[model samples]
Target: MHVATADQHTADWLMRFGLVRSEEHLNHYRRQGFAWMVARMFPNAGLEELCAFTDLNTLLFLLDDYLDHQESSASPENRDKKVKAMIDGFIRVLRQPKYGEQSGNPVFVALAELWQRMKKMSSRSWQRDFIQSIVAIFTAAIWQHENVKAGKWPLLADYMEQRQYLGAANIATDTIAVVDKIRLPRKMYEHPLLQELTALCRNTVCWANDLFSLSKEIAHGDYHNLVVLLSHEENISMEEAIVRACEIHDDQVKQFMRLCRYLPNEGPVMKMELHRYVEGLKNIMRANIDWSDYETSRYQYEYEEHVRTHKVREHYLMEAAV
Candidate 1:
């Protein structure tokens, strides 16, 4: 299925950018089956769009992992410098893709190529939206780093507000139009209803992830999770925090569903595109939960051994066939 297609493609893509250096690294990256999630989130995507989405998703996950590692291990001053460098390099590539082609950093070079590819597939407006989301991601990283440096957990409200951007859900959702080949007018896309729906979608995805990753984050003493933040801020038990976080996530899901009922009946084309976009958001929420439950080993330890074994067998089989 989608995993089979994206495995080779993503491995090659990551290796080309020097992001992955070994069979073990490729196995670890592929074990998450991000392409499977992307395929689920954008069910309407054709082959090309699916591949592009897979690469984009993989790149985002890589960046998040690298930064998260830096958050824990690197000194505050060192991490800040590294993060700033990344933000600057990425901004440069965003402005001019060719600028990073000659750079030594694989991430910069990779992003330059990926940005160029994305530009060819999206409208100018869509490109702008995607870039804004990316900048939000960089901003969120700085926000999180500052909180960590200060050794304080943000209040629940503040964490929720910024957590959506940290999750990159906006970038994922923004691609619906590209996948569907429907360019929404800026006015329609920015309508209050749609904007609210987008917020709900982002919150739902990010909070659900917090729920799934609670144990791991707690073990790592990472305070960037909603559940952890709520527990610490409210002086509540972990169980109480979990229950409250679930309540918040369920509320957002319900709100998203309720608002979809009132989608504007613009022109036929606009209406249809809006519905398609809404469906993609629904798919994203659904896929996030489903993937966390069934596919991702990051949250599910039982699945890790299963995934590792399966990947090893698949690798050997492919080698044997060759």
Candidate 2:
């Protein structure tokens, strides 16, 4: 099965990252340590490249915020610190003038403008909409660029003429279709020609979903209770929860690896590798907890202790209760 292979690949990758030493370790890492590791491990590529394409740092930061808020007894000050740290990192990356010693990446230019606009938006809904719009635009541009690079000028022209109609539709879905439809002159996926770019696209989609989920959690202030809620919803034991979390983390890592195979020679290989490192860091968080030792009734104490030590703050406790 595709899922089984993906799961096995993920597990092996996690082991290499030292993220699955034990169930207890997994829990601790997931609850408290993951965010810090992710923050430290994010890719060092310029902001322009990241914004133009899908990069992992933004998503990791979003997840870090989610975990910080979900821990019981998370403090207001701690939450603010995490948010500030994330924002500072974003600004640091974005302020850099030179990205990859290249020029005339229109997608990068568009993304810069979108990021600037997003930085100015105060409304959460508007910000989400803007991000979605930017992603759609970027996807379209990438597809067009791919066609041009492949020497499919006729198709490129066709796409340009239909751009307005296509732009009004869902970009991610449309781009996927475009990728499927394109007739490569040769078997491209295995050619080692566009491996990095392919991987970037795959990683970008996964990262985008991760970001979307984290943003939803933060906007609703439901971070602290997410794990407990997931356990309850699945009607699984704490041990089972740990197992599932490890499994999910592993799958994500494998997907990243698969994406790496699609990169072009000039693409950001280091950047993608750094993204994998962040994945390893997240696995560390998942590996630190011994979920099997705790009874359902003991969730509160374990969670509270985790939160207190982690300096979590400003979660929507009452809202999450519902």
| Candidate 1 worst ten-residue window by lDDT | 311-320
List the candidate 1 regions with Cα displacement exceeding 4 Å. 301-322
Count the clashes in each prediction: 0, 31
lDDT at position 321, candidate 1: 26
For candidate 2, what is the TM-score?
0.25
How much lDDT does candidate 2 score? 0.34
RMSD of 2: 19.9
- Over 41-63, each residue of candidate 2 has an lDDT whose tens digit, in order, gives 22332233222212122233233
Per-residue error (Å), model 1, residue 222: 0.4
Query: TM-score for every candidate vs. truth?
Result: 0.90, 0.25
RMSD, every candidate, angstroms: 7.9, 19.9
Give me the displacement of residue 119 in model 2, in angstroms.
Answer: 9.5
Query: Which lDDT values do the candidates have, in the order given?
Result: 0.78, 0.34
